[model samples]
Target chain A: MNAKTSSPIPPAEWIVAGMGLLVFTAVLGLMVWDAVAGDQSPPRITVEVDSITRSGDGHLLKFRARNDGGETAAEVVVEGELPASGGETETASATLDFLPAHSERKGGFFFKAQPERETVRLRASSFREP
Target chain B: MVRRGPKTLMSRRASATHKPAPRGTSRHFLRALARAFAGAIVFGLPLLMTMEMWWLGFHADRGRMALLFILSLPLLVGLSHYSGFEPTFGWVDDVVDTFVACAVGFVSSGVILLLFGLIEPGMAASEVIGKIGLQTLPASIGALLATGQFASPEEREADQKRFRKYQGELFLMMVGAIFLALSMAPTDEMMLIAYMMTPTHVLGLIFLSLVVMHAFVHAVESSGKAYVPSGTPFWSVFLRITIPGYVIALLISALILWAFERTDSCGPATLMGSVIVLGFPAAIGAGASRLII
Candidate 1:
């Protein structure tokens, strides 16, 4: 078996092996990077009730922020605000019973946003899929 | 283009028999049926899934083919058990599977729903990631832990190369599954509609399929040389890569579904009747992949 058949395998074979090995490393590196950089597991939703308010015209609202989710939703606890849109904010308790457990609930609060007072845009994080 | 098996395939005459027989009893018939069925499922499902997405996208405001296919994929696992071809490997197949699965999975995993939830309002990226993390971390950790120690490292590393390929395939399947879900979701921002669907019953079925199929695919093939084929082009790549992805996606979907169930949702179906009907094919056929073992 001289140079014709296979005296010895060509150095290119080693090159091919090296290339394959390189590709594996690169992919593994990428997977590891993704696992670290991304690695976001999932998401849980929890809601909090911040403030209960009563407006001047007569409406109620409960302020809330979510602990681990997107929206900081407000529920109507007292429901006296103007049907069109006018109200006040007040602090209160007993709003807990108003919300159904194991569910996201909305309620009217005693608080109202004065159309005049700079508009308080409620901000929150985006909702990521679970 | 190329379509489902037996019906339009070269061996239509034999496939017409539709009888299940041992290898030699009717070798050509079974092979034909397998090829035809394989052709239908491999080419057909994707096409159908793609069409559904297209329909949704065109007909509705927000339609995604990949997401729809990914999400609806569980339905196929049950169906596929009845079909005759399985996914195996060639480089091209692996690549396609990965891309398709990733695109679809990301969309279905509530990504669309999150967008809708915020479209009414708006949410920041950090808030989104953070919120998602909070919801997912505990669950992910619990799952990773509960799955417990692999009874064998010899098992995982048994065929590292094959295992990696298998993992990659499974990942693609997950993406495909989610795409299926997203595609089905009507584009309009109806939180009520999407959420109503998310109640875990429908989602649970998808997850369960993923788990059973994934466990089978991985456990069996993970331990041996994956069925890598000779030189290939289109079909080889298409089939090789996507099949494993399909299996893995099945499992990932299940985990996602299970998580949804755990947190808060509708009542779990307490009946063996419904669960059994749904679960049998996926469990048994996926288990058959142990043939690879």
Candidate 2:
């Protein structure tokens, strides 16, 4: 098998391969840890307005939905409510396909009335179990 | 690239076999690493583009993912023994090659997925790891097989000869089956199609899968006289290799489905249906592994 006479591997090759081994080990460790003792809470989604942009004839409320729990939330519905002075609540809603745990997804809601920073409220309305 | 068939195998036998490429230099090793990268992209791009695969990265069972990772190591080692990036002289060399290929797979997957916007800076470490880790196995196997793909036909023929034994052939079939099955198992269509099929459809598919698999392998085996004796009866080869190869494909299909959590909600009938459906592609892969890998 030429075991005795085989050439030594390049040092750089060894270093890269070692790094590879480290990568695999870290991934496997994280997965195992997650399976064993990682977070068990259901998906907790929170939405926040990122910016207000003026579109043609309307304003776009850009938001980021962040999932802080241990599970994935699918079909997450985020709503932005603008309470008008006439006891009417104008709601702009957007549905995110998924908000995975510890991850963030970007979405936007459009409203005809210019929303004030103080009265504009953003909330995750609902999410289904993924 | 030269297309190698039984003719090349036969022609190469009259001349002396070519020596395996030398290993150990940094430049040479780096070249092999580059080939590994190319291979990773070639084999892994389909799955990387699949949305279901991305979803499974975070939502699939962690234990099953871990199990698949653990199982891939031995599979990589065996693959390295046969056709690693650079020729290896010992088990240590093969192990080194295995790790190198894995690193190549991991890095390539990360880089490509990031470019696709599937992975980003703020993404959770678990999700990023899961996505890349799941892709590493197929890419690593591709990295290992890269050598054969790029080698001269004679070198590839020699490599094939190393694993020409019955057990070796079976192992190769399993690898091929797993490779093809992994690509298809993550899609919801596997279940959807299974759900759409009736008992008669399922039966027809099974019969068709067997016929296609046997026909392909038989053609390949017959073309290469070294693979089977010329006088061997059709039923003998059918029973000995084709049937067993299909069984391996089905088992691999089932394993991949279970690993991806596709079978979690399935009843026995549905599970069997999906396995058979996947078995079709896997069987094709197994039968044609000799040509591709």
Q: Among these predicted structures, which one has the highest DockQ?
A: 2
Every candidate's DockQ is: 0.03, 0.73
Worst 10 residues of 1 chain B by lDDT: B142-151
Q: Taking the tens digit of each residue's C-alpha lDDT, what string does model 1 give over A46-69? A: 434444455678544444533332
Q: Model 1, DockQ value?
A: 0.03
lDDT of 1 at B196: 42
- Residue A91 lDDT, candidate 1, scale 0-100: 36
In terms of docking quality, model 1 is: incorrect
Across residues B1-293, which tens digit of lDDT does each residue of candidate 2 receive?
Answer: 13445656655664446443456678778778888888888888888899998898888788999999999999999888877777676898889889998899999988988898998866799999999898888888888888766655556666778767887788888877877888999998999999999999999999998898888777777767225655578898889888999999999999998998888878999999999999999998888777667
Per-candidate count of clashing residue pairs (backbone under 3 Å): 70, 0
Task: Please give each candidate's TM-score.
Answer: 0.27, 0.93
lDDT of 2 by residue, A1-130 (tens): 5653468999989998898899889989999998999887998888877889899999988988899999988999888999987899899889999888899999888898898778899999898987
Overall lDDT per candidate, in order of appearance: 0.32, 0.85
Task: Give the alpha carbon lDDT tens digit for every residue of B1-293 in model 1.
Answer: 12324323533444456543322223533342233323322322332333222222111111122232333334333222211121213333223222222222222322433543521232333333323222221121111111012112222233233334544334323433433322222222222333444336555755565555545544444444344332434355434543444444445434333322321343354222222322334343434432311
At residue B288, give the lDDT of candidate 1.
41
